[model samples]
Target chain A: MAIDFKQDILAPVAADFAAMDKFINEGISSKVALVMSVSKHVVEAGGKRMRPIMCLLAAQACGENDLTQTQRLAAVIEMLHTATLVHDDVVDESNLRRGRPTANATWNNQTAVLVGDFLIARSFDLLVDLNNMTLLKEFSTGTCEIAEGEVLQLQAQHQPDTTEETYLSIIHGKTSRLFQLATEGAAILVGKPEYRQALQQYAGHFGNAFQIIDDILDYTSDAETLGKNIGDDLMEGKPTLPLISALSKTSGTDHEIIRKSIATGGLTELDDVIRIVQNSGALDYCRLRAQQETQLAIDALAILPESIARQGLYNLAMLALDRIQ
Target chain B: MAIDFKQDILAPVAADFAAMDKFINEGISSKVALVMSVSKHVVEAGGKRMRPIMCLLAAQACGENDLTQTQRLAAVIEMLHTATLVHDDVVDESNLRRGRPTANATWNNQTAVLVGDFLIARSFDLLVDLNNMTLLKEFSTGTCEIAEGEVLQLQAQHQPDTTEETYLSIIHGKTSRLFQLATEGAAILVGKPEYRQALQQYAGHFGNAFQIIDDILDYTSDAETLGKNIGDDLMEGKPTLPLISALSKTSGTDHEIIRKSIATGGLTELDDVIRIVQNSGALDYCRLRAQQETQLAIDALAILPESIARQGLYNLAMLALDRIQ
Candidate 1:
């Protein structure tokens, strides 16, 4: 049976999720018209809001009943996610996200860039209001690493020499670190110190699995299927896991072609590159890795109390994995 | 007598200034090579270190002799300033700042944007270590307003009907708000709540005076005199104070010309716009406004016990005015 996200995952925390969603709306309110409009556009364009939901689930799983602060934390997580997405669109020069025109596309880069900055600052502003020093420190440090991760990805662009270890580091920073913050932050907020490690572990592995799947889809899926063009990463010469693994498993002309594609980003050789990635067993290895990561994520949740919320987090991870299957 | 910045303003807090300068250098150190290089390049290209020096002087004026935390706060001010400058360069698509190549020019827009983000996160990370909720709230709120101000400026761009009140709001967000944070933050950190209002008032007015004079010089000063090109504001179609005032004080073809110049940014009618602004007495009115703001700034320092540090703040305001004289 397939996992139904609304029924199995979000059901237990549906009320909290709604409240958290409202907080996000109220939190991004600004006096500037453009800032407000662009923020609303991007936030509404946001897909699933998985991170904030994970935060809400993690809080409930910890057996903490009081949730006034938890809701705000959830909103902060989503705002930070939205802020990065806005900047990412500018960095990628992308015109669409989730089939909607991106902030950069609808408005100019100047407006997107400045409004993105506003969102980031506003996220921090809301986090400060939660009045938890531990949470603040974690977020501050986590956000710095997130930026570093983004820069590292840029530094690695087109370099075929980037190893899996380096790839893990990048994904951990860019994607998983925020996941860690969301779950671990919730645990800290709920006064459940013992659950911090378990939740961090769960979020870290789950985030790694999620990004690996995204990278795989980048090579395998097209605009009609995923709302993201196939070969988008290759177009940027990003040595994502698929290409990295493909480079290791093949040699001769095929390896050289993959390397050239990575070094010089564009789509002229995209068909050949995709064929090579598929034939070279790179996608298989990526699938195995994603599965292993998903299992570890679910296993970590065992440390949390056996509540509907923990099961919700578990179901959410499995549902993410079901995407590729 | 002309005020010497080194002798009159910096001398009182010279030792603290040097220490604060070192802190800025230490603060920007990052493991990522690109982040480190871009941050160092921008910091080395920094002009006068005026904001951080103001931070030091403000701390001293509050009768707080222990200089440890104050130096860090000073560094934070400079870091925040550099972050905005980095993003500003990207938004403006400029190659130079203070006669040096900007981060975007030296690297790329993508690199500049990401590094700017890293600097902002690092600043907040360091701020969290200080463990002061009130100070954190002030900065968090101040940064949000600062971003809104920048967006407001963008919104006002190429807009001819921008009001003086709106322009003040813009400058308050873009320029003076940070100055308020630099000084007012010092008061908050030093356990001097009594000094907060007066220091905030001084910095706010001083920043207003500073920006008005800069705008005045755009019409009145040449590249050789101020290292800023005449009619550069017109080139960007920035509805700054001179053009806004000119709009208020003119009509007929002159008023229409100013309005058109603002509505469509470029240097096509640079000379005519300059002449009209000068002949219409817009620059004179701007100068008078600058002087009034400067006087109000100096008057705010009367609440502080007269110390050389207070005098340094006063002299800093005077030196800014000296540029026009």
Candidate 2:
């Protein structure tokens, strides 16, 4: 069954999700015109806003009816996400994101970097206004881990020896950590400590599944798969799951080809690398792993009482798997 | 007699300043090797540790005998300073800072940007541990202004018509705001609200004077001046006070030369701009402004009772002026 993101996931918190945009606009508002314009460009360029939507859904699932504070929290989540994406575009030297010209491409790297910084500081400023000590601590610590995860991924680049454990840690930091913060933070803000662990677990596994699906798409060349550029990961020598799995399954020439591609980080052998990755059943292993993570994510929700919001959260994880399917 | 920084300023906070390094080392300690190394490189390359020293002196002047928390605060100030410098190098695209290879040059822009982010996040994580809401709010707000200031400077670049008022605004954000946070944050941490305004005023004015002197030195080449390369600002079309003042003082070819130099941002007319700026009484006006700001900074310290720490703060501002003298 095809899951409609609007009907299945975002529907539960559509009103609050829309309300979150005001706080986002307010958050990015600055006295400096350049800061405002560059920030507005990047924040608007944000894709789907999955993290904040998850936050809104998690707040609803926590049995909290008043979502005024949660809406602000969702805005902070989106701002932080936007900030990272802005820097990511600078780091990747990427010109286009979601079919829109990136901040780095449109303005310049210098403007993009400073405006990204403004968004981060502004996010923290808004987060402080919530005045919740526990929430602040969680976010502060979570941000550090998120940055470390990004650096870890950079460190792992071109290193074919990067183990699966290392890969998991990287994804956990870069992808899962923020997701954990989004849901767990809502639970924290709403004074629902009881739900913190369960929501964090659900979001963590779900984030892993989401990223794995993303990594799978980088190699999956379906003409219908909108933005997924085939062999993008291989071209960067990013030893994502497919390459990591292929490393273990192949031997001799196949292994050497994979190793050289990762180390050199180019597209000269993209076809052979993709063929070996497919032939070695690495993609199958990756799909199985994604399925397991999605199931674990869904299982984590058993602790929460049945609600439309919980079902929405479950649907988000399932929708991620649908990408792979 | 030339002021000895060690005896005149650092002498008061020497032991505490040395102890602060322990906290700095701990703050940069990350599980990720790349984050740790990049952070360590930048933090270690820090010059004179002026900001943290000012913070310790401010804490002492606030009559806080217990230096434990203050030391950690000083470390946070340094980390924040280091993070900004790392990003600044990336923005400026300069290969060297204080004659040391920048993080962007040492690793890559990607590593520098992400690790700079780690330093920022880690600084906030340490700050949240202080459990002082007032201090957190001050820092969160101050960092936003700093980023805005940086963007404002970028906006002002190649703009020959940048007014002195706009120049002050740029310097305040790029330089003084953090200085305000450092001293003001110390006061906030130590429960010295009464001293907060005075310290903030002192640091803010001191930051202005310090940056003005730096801008003056950008055009002042005595050959013995270590890192102050003449016309560096003009080369980048950075309309510092000298150029802003020159615009007010000159006419005809000299005026057009300055305007064109700023508008174009290169070294072709560098000699003409420098000759006009030096001959046009613009540097004189900038020197007067720096002196006025230094006096204001020192006067702000009058609210604090006479103490060696206060004297140290005074001397730090004085030493900044000694460069111009």
Q: List the residue pairs that clash in candidate 2.
A: none
- lDDT score of residue A244 within candidate 2: 95
Cα RMSD of all models vs. native, in order, equals 1.0, 1.2
Report the lDDT tens digits of candidate 2 across residue range A1-325: 7889999999989999999989999998888999988988888888899999999999999999899999999999999999998998898788878778999999999998888888889999999999999999999999999989989998999999999999999999989999999999999999999999999999999999988988988888543564536776777788899999999999999999999999999899988998998999999999999999999999999998899999999999988888878
In candidate 1, the residue pairs with backbone N, CA or C atoms under 3 Å apart (3 or more residues apart, or in different chains) clash, namely none
User: How does candidate 1 score on lDDT?
Assistant: 0.92
Docking level of model 2: high
Per-residue lDDT of model 2, residues B212-325, tens digit only:
999988888643464535777877889999999999999988999989999999889877777898999999999999999999999999999899999999999999999899
Evaluated at residue B81, the lDDT of candidate 2 is: 93
List ranges where model 2 is wrong by over 4 Å.
A222-224, B222-224
Candidate 1 residue-wise lDDT, B83-172, digit = tens: 999999999888888888899999888888899999999999989999999999999999999999999999999999899999999999
Q: How well is candidate 1 docked (DockQ)?
A: 0.88
Candidate 2 lDDT: 0.91
Chain B TM-score for the candidates in order: 0.98, 0.98
